[model samples]
Target: MATNVLICDDSSFARKQMARAIPKEWEVDIHFAGDGVEGVQAIREGKGEVVFLDLTMPNLDGYGVLETIRKEDLPAMVIVVSGDIQPDAQDRVKKLGAMAFIKKPIDAEKAREVLTEYGILTGA
Candidate 1:
């Protein structure tokens, strides 16, 4: 089966960028969510096995979503994709059970790195 990925970001541009960056060979099933609330709902609805989450959102920010996921025992690996490069922010998200932290302006190389790190993309 193909790996599934959920992208949650408020910016349409970001979403488009991410869509393009992910390698086609991976055959990933991508799903988009405009905010954390929707992202959480999508996860609950069995959208994906991994989530690309944005930290700064209007409603139910990434932290809150992570907390909810942890509290509810949701089975998904969350990779925080955000522009917030602050050390504290990254640390907090890491503590919240995020599988990885990926900086924004995502590129194909970074996407591949993340997937490989999580064992989602194989064949080194």
Candidate 2:
């Protein structure tokens, strides 16, 4: 099955970088959202099964999106991708229901590991 994925970040560069980092073997229907509001909306619309979410963004932030997802019981696994490597930030996201927290300059290998660990990816 092709997984629906969302990349939510204010920086176009980050979004593109994340898109590139995704393994081609995942068979994802990729979508982009510039902020948390759009990310939440995309989740509501069932456009995302897995989300790569940025912490700091204009209009809405990643935390807000996670909160919305939890409140609404949205069916998307959020993986936080942030420049802030603070342990506090990581804990907060996890408490808010993020499946994983990855620091800035996402590593493709780590990304795959997270997905695989979460049972979102298997095999190749």
Candidate 3:
């Protein structure tokens, strides 16, 4: 079965880059959301089994999305992809419930490693 994946970022370029990093072998139905509000809505609509989220967005932001997910007990795994590489930012997202944080201009190898670590993707 194909996994439902959501990439939520304000930058269209960032979204495309993130999309490209997803392993070719992974079966997924990818969805795009321009901001957190749309991201949350997409999650609720079951378009986001796994979410690649950007921290700085208009309206809700990544932290707000995490809070919404936690508060609502939403069933989605979040991996924050952001230019914010601050340790405090990473800790905050981890505390808020993100599976991991990938520094922006995401690397395909790193993405694959994270996915493999979390058992979201299998095989070598």
Who wins the lDDT comparison?
3
> What's the lDDT for candidate 1?
0.89
Candidate 3: lDDT of 44? 96
Q: Residues 1-124, candidate 3, lDDT per residue (tens digit)? A: 8999999999999999999999999999999999999999999999999999999999999999999999999999999999999999999999999999999889999999999999999974
RMSD of each: 1.1, 0.7, 0.7
Per-prediction TM-score to the true structure, in the order listed: 0.95, 0.97, 0.98
Per-residue CA lDDT of model 1 for 24-69, tens digit only, reads 7886789999998999999998785888899999888999999999
lDDT by candidate, in order shown = 0.89, 0.92, 0.97
- Show pairs that collide, candidate 3: none
Q: For candidate 1, what is the total of clashing residue pairs?
A: 0
Model 1 stretches with alpha carbons more than 4 Å out = none
* Highest-scoring model, TM-score: 3
What is the lDDT for 42 in model 3? 98
Q: Over the stretch 57-100, how does candidate 2's per-residue lDDT look in tens digits?
A: 98889999999999889999999999999989999999999999
Clashing residue pairs, candidate 1?
none
List where candidate 2 sits over 4 angstroms from the true fold.
none
